[model samples]
Target chain A: MGTELVGGRTVLGTLRSDPPLTLRQTGHGTVHLVSTAAGPLGGDRLELAVDVAPHTTLEIASVASTLVLPGNGESLTVVEARVGAGATLRYAPEPTVLAAGCAHRMVVRLVLEEGASVSWREEIVFGRYGERPGTCHSRFDATIGGVPLLRQEFVVGDPAVDGSPAVYGDARCVGSVLLAGPAFGHPGPGNGGRPGNPRGHASVIAEGCAVLPLAGPGTLVSALAPDAATLRARLTWGLGRS
Target chain B: MDAALLLLADSRLPAGGHGHSGGAEEAVRTGAITGPEDLARFLRGRLTTAGLVAAALAAAACELATAPGAAADQAGTRPDEPAAGAAPESAWRELDAEADARTASPAQRNAARTQGRLLLRSARRIWPSPALDTLAGAVPDGAHHPIALGAVSAAAGCSPHDAALAAAYTSITGPATAAVRLLGLDPVVVHRVLAGLVPDLTSVARTAGARAAWERLPAHAAPALDLLAEQHLRTEVRLFVS
Candidate 1:
């Protein structure tokens, strides 16, 4: 059976995986699900719970992007992504592309409990103009403590505008490059994926256009790419330097 | 009012609106906006996210009448809290505060207020609404464009919602004028683009009123067009102010 557990508040849940990770579905390829029983808040603050046992390595797809939607009710969507001191969570979904007309809000708090390693990505499509249908307006915020950790809000579908003046010139696609880590501590331009650089990097690639890696020192700051080659150079420089 | 729509596009008018391409220049040069479809996309995006700056300001102006102390804030000072008389006025004061807080850009705050002041002066001379007369006397210098537009709209034989329509339309035409100056697209084509885009603005204004009527709040995603605008400000060559 493919199942797992979870937790809340930075994750109040104990996390488990389905199919043991290595055992894939052969045909459909591999799908990894990390379940947790983190306490969720609702009537009485949803206390999230999280539990991740050591020695468990989860295989994840190097997704193109990942997008978080908005809150369901009056409450915000809180997701606690935690990696145990020894446990690793590789979350490389196929760049969870956000469709136009999607206005969501979410809170993603990750707890890398010492020695824990996880690869996470978040991306959004500004649409390829008429080829696409709409835009997305969502907010993503996270914090390790009362201090800020990762706070991002990408609100698409602003009924106010259809396109951005930068890429399209009264055009439609706009990708906000926001990614950060210890590597990009200073407010300098970031390179593309190199490796070992700061492991914290987020990027977005629209169509065949250049893929921009929002690689920086902070989790919320992104270094944008003007073209695909630039994006490649950025990733190469970033990972290479690392 | 359509002439108001036209004047909004006429950067030549001394409204200082010329300084701002309404984000058109930045979006195009930066690659966020391009071409016709891209232009449409850019328009929609601007209207929804960045456009809120104007919409909310317009809405606040429309609601100024009910605010008891609205006159004080309007008197060249930031729109202030309603007077301390009634409970409802106090609620509007809180609403005005939220609107100010949500408008995070200092420059935009200036632009809105600047446009408002001039608009109020012109509108007050042409037509008179008790709301405008009272608020004008209470507020200082050029009131923000929204407050001016909303109040002025009432004075000019229009509704708050109609003011919103005009306010929203202003954002688009400003850029089209830039496109004409920048690209020299045919006169007919420019009008064609306007014709197609106009309905969207009208619809957005109505929807905005409906949404504002409810939560009395609409989405707040003022895309940091200021970044591009800031860059433009530093550039040696630029056609618009913003």
Candidate 2:
């Protein structure tokens, strides 16, 4: 739903959303999504759609943390986006805190054209205060020219499942960074003018998608971390910000 | 059940599986897994997430190989003519990309490709099918492990479901075997943990076989696994490749 501009900058097009979701343009190709309903309530179904034209860039961020309260039914959020050739989208949403008795699922699906690029980040905290976390499932799928580029799914805080070392390894906060496009090449720590940050480990899984993980000090520390602020700061640092 | 599937699932098939621990070595080094209980939990989580993803990819690949016109395309004579369902080369590349997306560590990606290449080498001799040859020609460095497994499974006259079963079983077996060697856990106890997982493995394979399209394949991922794979690569002394 977007087209190329003269300078090859990506501008948002056909931005559509409903209640509890507000949009404010912070800068060119940048918009901040603000929630007005405190947070997603029980049985809430939310959808956000974005279209980035060719030669345009879109940066999206949430105004605050998405706090999931106790709900009678499961809450869901679905995001669908299309990036044209030479377009880019940087999606860095705030941390999501799953409260007790909450069930939430978020699905993000993106379709990219040749030469398109996308950088996305998601942070999840088990609980806000001292309460146990609820069930949460997050899925991400991206395709280029109808071909799959990346696909990932995460399930957290389910009572039926044991705290497997392979899944979370006692980490309460989990953060992920995904960069895909012609612009994002495979760059390790030593190269790319970026010193290696030991706070997180990044790997270029493919030509496009790269993953970074941020956790706490020891096994106990990582598991008992009260919040995601430390992890977020590390993530911001990992993404090359001062 | 196809007898060839047993060969593909065997750890002693000279597929380079023995050299890789599937990140279990790193997990042990970090003290994330110290006993049979922890190992069981780890395997269960891995079986549902990474194992499911691999099973789905293998199933889809097998379906692609056995599709109509696959035999004709295997001749490698028709670079212009598209296959009956999806173009074989593009489809294989797309599947490979999905595999890359699902894997978030450079070490794991390299390990997968290495294993894939080794598997293809053995398959070309044992099965000697045109589909496998064409796939081998397409990705000289090697397709991802699941992609190669599917193609080889089809060549060996196995169904997509059988391929899925093989893929699912191998995902945990590699790491379990590695734990036995690294942690010196009792082999019987280590295998009992695996034996307890038969029902889940069957469920995962069934789910994988249900999906026919590559685009709709499972993307379940454990971020801890990605982290472990990267950490395993940096260790000064390590027993396994990943």
Off by over 4 Å in 2: A1-17, A26-29, A159-162, A186-226, B68-87
lDDT tens digits by residue: candidate 1, B65-119: 5443543343223344435432232333333333333332334445555666676
lDDT (Cα, tens digit) per residue for candidate 1, span A73-167: 22233445554555545444332333333333444555544445445544344433243423443444322212223333455454443334432
- Categorize the docking of model 1: incorrect
Question: Could you give candidate 2's per-residue lDDT for residues B1-242 as a string of tens digits?
Answer: 99888888988887788988888998899898999998998998888888999999898788778883553343233456655653356556655666776765556667888899999998899889878877877677788899899998999999989999999999999999999999999999998999999999999999988854455567887767776776677689988888
Report the number of the highest-TM-score candidate.
2
DockQ of each: 0.09, 0.35
The residue-by-residue lDDT of candidate 2 on A79-132, one tens digit each, is 888988877777888888988778899999988886777777778888876778
TM-score of 2: 0.85
